[model samples]
Target: MKSTYQTKDFWAGCVYVAIGLAAILIAQDYKMGTAARMGAGYFPRVLSGLLMLIGLASILRAFLQPGERVERIQLRPMLLIVGSTLIFAASVRYLGTVIAVPLMGLLAASASRMFRITVPALVGLALLTAFCTIVFQMGLGVPLPILGSLFGG
Candidate 1:
């Protein structure tokens, strides 16, 4: 008999199970401690177990309910998103948050079809830069420079 379930859910469930089992294995060496006095591994182990359960439920739900078929993944957006993250990580140390934050915003915006190099994108960049600066630098008092040594700061 043909299965009514989507293959995607089954595979996703398998992945979750694998990850949970791996976490359990890795945490085995660490001291679990009591429920009151949790050890370092306890949280990860518990979270992984939960993830596995959720994945299993998703798989089961797929069989019982109708769902939209899996769509093809878009590579351009994925690449741009990953590239933006890498750019931010690489530049933040040298260029500092003031420069890197806006740059990341621009790059991330470029990943979407809705955004373009226009007034709105520029305004978004400005807003994001201000928000990040206020939150991470002023409010949180992170040690990152407003302008790095590269900029003669």
Candidate 2:
């Protein structure tokens, strides 16, 4: 019989519960107002409460139902994805949305074992970059440049 502590659902539930509780605790410092006029902490507190409820349900389900054991973490894909995210954060200001988004997308996509650079992949990257540029830079008027200072924009 598989131990309850070894189940994937149990660990996932624990993670969710920890994060929810942390958020709830952090939110307590801010004032919570009525639903109609929510204060700074209201949304975080409400969302954290819901997250805690979901986590509790999952924890209960883990005890009631047999589940697969937690698998070993895949290092390559995890490192690639995390590295790409860090690169994106570090490069966004200098490279701007136009370059950084596609660069990050390419790096992230390469994390997949079946990843390949094809016409379709390139098109997807282009579309992603365009969407980010339009929505974040143009539409939302975020300060991110279309082309950054490095490109003399």
Could you give candidate 1's per-residue lDDT for residues 1-153 as a string of tens digits? Answer: 134444666667778888888888888888888799999888888988898898888778667763555567899999889999999888787898889888888888788888768887688788888888899889999888778668975
TM-score, model 1 to reference: 0.62
Candidate 1: the clashing residue pairs are none
Displacement of residue 26 (Cα, Å) in model 2 is 15
**TM-score (C-alpha, index-matched) for candidate 2:** 0.56
Minimum summed lDDT over a 10-residue window in model 2 is located at 1-10
User: Candidate 2 regions off by >4 Å?
Assistant: 1-70
C-alpha lDDT of residue 146 in model 2: 83
lDDT of 2 by residue, 41-89 (tens): 9999989999988888887888999588898989999988999999988
lDDT of 2 at 101: 90
TM-score of each predicted structure versus truth:
0.62, 0.56
